[model samples]
Target: MPDFTATTPHIIPLVYQPDSAHWFALVRHLPHAVWLDSGRPQSTYGRFDIIAAAPQCLVETRGANTSIRYDDGRTDESALDPFYLLKKYLPADQLPEHSNSNLPFIGGALGYFAYDLGRRLETMPNLARNDIALPDMSVGIYPWAIIQDHQHKTACLVINTELGQRLGDAYNFLEIEQLCASAAKNPAFHEAINCIKSVQKSFKISEFESNLKVEEYQQALAKIHDYIRAGDCYQVNFAQRFSAEFSGDPLIAYLALRQALPSPFSGFMQLEAGSVLSLSPERFIQVRDKRVETKPIKGTIKRGATPEEDAANAEWLQNSLKNRAENVMIVDLLRNDLSKHCAQVRVPTLCELQTFANVHHLVSTVTGELTPNATALDLLRDAFPGGSITGAPKIRAMEIIEELEPTRRSLYCGSLGYISADGQMDTSIAIRTLVCDGDKIHCWGGGGIVADSETEQEYRESIAKVKVLMDTLEKEFGS
Candidate 1:
């Protein structure tokens, strides 16, 4: 097996900026561009934003098929496990240590691993319709990245020196350094600004349509209630999909949504098929220096109109017995998943109140140390699509989700983030996410269905979670 090892990254310092939206203009037009954005900018949860474009290689997996296409016209296809295939290229042992511990990613695989990819990992009955035929996994092996450190007020261009040496041309350190030096002076920024403004006025639709009607959603909730009573599963996370016709650049929509609803684990990826716009506040997993942590968000309540109302709403969520039970159930499931590749698995916090722009969430922190032989991908494979999104008994919950949900979840409830060459990894639950494919853009909102979960309350909660996102886009471009 050929290992694409990386040497110490060449970090070139650049001017600092709080809002990354302007800086992203530099690489927006590049092919296969990706931005792992900390949407909150300089806040506590928000610290780093990594942007990369024109990957050295692209890895895409659909069902049992995975193809790795390199920039030099080298292509390889295989039916191997996607995680095993990724391991061949991103083996954790090959990365060298660097002094810059503050930055999470220098150059590595940055993209989305779709929730449907779980089918490739576990044996489950095919029930949901595959209407949105997106690749289960699509990530680019980038050779260089532009990192924005919002907390320290610093920015830099980091080039993976070893990968650059092989790719040559624009990838070489000198060329990238020259590119960064001339970036600010380039005339493209003005054009990018104009392009964004023009695209913002392109939406023609007046409303979004959901996959499930109110009665249909209520019926699905009844089935979940039946399962809970019969001891089929303790809890199952159910969701509804909403879609609108979209024709213009999706970046305009992303920019609008992020501004209105800033989150810690937000990301945007431009792919060959379409684009992924995520504004997720939940961290599915993070691995650094062999230490692992997964933050699962289970409970939720919509934000109130006034300050007092907001506090009361948050307090209600924090004290909700049903929500707390739903949260702890998933926490236990994740603990078992982490233990498969980690040691001394522990839960540091449970059902802690964390408020986002649109909702109040009960977020819990689960931590552990990676077993000596385990890699980041190994940990990801064991945990798969995350327990919080799936449910308490993950396999059973996923089975129920498949049986009840009308259509396949292409990107929603999956994960979007990075696994750096330095062995550091972080990913979002891919909730509050939108997928722009073909002529339509799709979004989903859902919550856990416990025994006591009411049909009306669950339905209202689902819409409440993503109401801000839908409103923001529709307000900006009509629908």
Candidate 2:
């Protein structure tokens, strides 16, 4: 277990403007890059953007590498993680954490951990019938990176590989004056350079089809309540999916979605099979300086139009016994999960109602110290498919989810982010995530169900949770 503090990457500061347009133009066409932007001015990570690519290695799998999973419905477990897991691949060195430098991120593996990978950890069946035939997991190790800090208005382009090996006369290529002069000569680059703020180009696409009918969702919610009464599980998070086929640009759709609902964990990635557009607000797990933390969001409510009305709604949410109870359940579950790989597991805070642009969520913060022997893969195995999205009594809740949900979750409830060259990492709970599968797009949302949960209320809550993204998609593709 090596820490990144010992390794230092080649860092070159650039004359970066506080915008994504110019940055988007250069990397939009690059292969295997991750663009994680905190669209919101006020974000948890101080409004940072990271564009990393040029993967030296790629790893994709449906099952846990430690587990022996046969295609013919047979499987075995090894209680270990893949040797090539992101945790192991992070460079031995990292960028300085102090404010003196513009680099907020170190180069590392950037991609996603799909929700279906849960079956590999502990056997909970998956039919593996993917409509898009997308990989269960896709993570790449990018050797080059560009990191920006909006608040400080500074940026840097970092290369992990040597100048002679990867780029000829790399020092000359790393010069800001030379790059600026070259960009000034290009039309698109010049336009982006002059662009002042983030601008989204509107788009239009086809309508969508719901996998679960409104009535079907209500019925399923009621059945979940019945299961609760029968002592099967205390809480279960369930979801409904809406899918549509589109031939337009998904990156443009992602841009519109960001404008509509800017969240801290939102990101966009163009992969071989399709593109992943995410607008998630929940922070599943973040590790920095060798410390582990998880922010589990368990409650949701729509915002009100007036200040008085908004205050009333916030107060109502804070005082809601049902929502508060659900929030604590998942927090406790995460605490338990962290305990396996982390020492001194503790809950720093609980049930803080954080308001977003369109909705409010009861979020709780849990922190711990990762044990000396634990690796990043350990955290993924222990706390993955996030307790907030899955439910308390994690395994049992998943069983119920598998039986009720119509479509395979694919990347919906899974997570996406970076495992830095060192060990520092941050991943979102993959909520409000949209998968662009060829000409078809898929998205899902839902909530925790308790013993006294109301079917109609739960169904409505699920719809409200995803309304922002749905509206963005509709407007982007509206007739």
Candidate 3:
């Protein structure tokens, strides 16, 4: 662990405020750069375009992160939790404050969390789907940052006193400004001049193929129904993945996906393990000022073809007993999880209808005040692999998921965000995500399964969740 004890912290300049999309084009070309965008009408944190090719340290776990307990059929040990690895390696840094400052990711780890990492926390009593192969966690350190504040129309560069020695570059304010100015004007990269289109109407639902055939899914859903009836579990969120081997340029696919569905929690991470492209709309957990909040999404309906149709769909979902019931189960699950480290727990909103480019979801917000000694890691450990993804009585639901699904969920349900050096953290539920490893690309979608969940309906719902990402890949590489 390299010491980054900055004697004095300082700020730099990014010159012109580069458009987030075009800037992303430039940043993604670099190594270990992550773009966390919450453009206007922000979702969680304000807009952040920060990268660290020259990290102070890097940590990724292999078979050592998680000790094997009950391996029903899994051969690989769980990799370390990237979030936990980051909290251990990086020193706590409360960023320098300013009236116009927007992002809290001053100097933190920029990486991802793999769904398989859960094996570290609990035993896999059932068989894993073994869907794909990828690292459980990977994070690059960034002791310096250049941020763009879209709301205020300004850009600022932040760094610690270790200054010029970190990246081995003799950098001054003027030089840093010139370097950014150059990146902004690079003619080869098209500038992301306007907002990403909010709606995409070209995709047809019939184009996607399911990992499990119709009859297969129906039989599986029946088994889950049996479990519910037997009092084995109340609700289980069973999910199946949709994937095809693709060799297209990942950046192009990401660009197309973002254009079709612009969102607040969207991110692009280029790591040695693989390329991560996420347009997630769900906020799993956020800790700031010792307060923890989670917004779990349980019920979903496809966005209608027209405005009237869309309104009708939203209205139906809002009032649907099944949808609301599905939502409340997860809310109860999360509330109980947070209670472990929280002094107080409250549900600010219940079964609220929220719209996205491709679908409408029933969401509920859960908030808790941290106990005296609770840290950000504590909040994540207490409530992770979010309740919405796993069903009510989380542990059993997860065990059922492993037995039924065909492959491990590498990153689909895991999170991708920053745990700030200052200790403020925000991460998404890892839905609407794509992982590119070599010539293959993996994506997953599913919904919570309750007593009344229909086999075909649940299958269609899972497909609907991943429709945007699948279509983007199809258009770019589906040929």
Q: Quick one: best TM-score, which candidate? A: 1
* Candidate 2 residue 327 C-alpha distance from true site, Å: 0.6
Clashing pairs in 1: none
Pairwise TM-score winner, candidates 1 and 3: 1
Name every residue pair that clashes in candidate 2.
7-93, 91-421, 203-476, 204-476, 204-477, 205-477
lDDT of each: 0.85, 0.73, 0.68
lDDT of 1 by residue, 1-479 (tens): 55655457878888776777766776778789898899856335878899888888889999889999887777899999988887765754622333245678867789999999999989989989998867999988887889998878899988886664444344534555676788667767545556676766665544788999999999999999999899999999999999998777888878888888988899999888799999999898898877789999999998889999999999999999999999999999999999999889999898999988888899999999887767788889889999999997899999999999999999898999998877789888999999988888899999999999989999999999999999888877784
Residue-wise C-alpha lDDT for candidate 3, range 1-479, written one tens digit per residue? 35333234466665535456655554455556677765333333345555444444555555356322111222234355545545554443332222122456566566676766677778776366554656676655556666667656666666643533443344344543465568646754443332222222321222345687777777778888998999988898777777666553465666677767777777777765467888888888887766789999888999999999999999999999998998988899999999998867999999988888789988899999877656666677667778788786888888888878767788878887776665667888888888877666777888888998877788888888887777765664455
lDDT of 3 at 433: 87
TM-score of each: 0.95, 0.86, 0.84
lDDT of 3 at 395: 84
Ranking by lDDT: 1, 2, 3
| TM-score between candidate 1 and the true structure | 0.95
Pairs clashing within candidate 3: 12-157, 22-192, 93-421, 93-422, 129-406, 129-407, 130-407, 130-408, 131-407, 131-408
Q: Please list the Cα RMSD from the true structure of every candidate, rounded to 1 decimal place.
A: 2.1, 5.6, 6.4
C-alpha root-mean-square deviation, candidate 1: 2.1
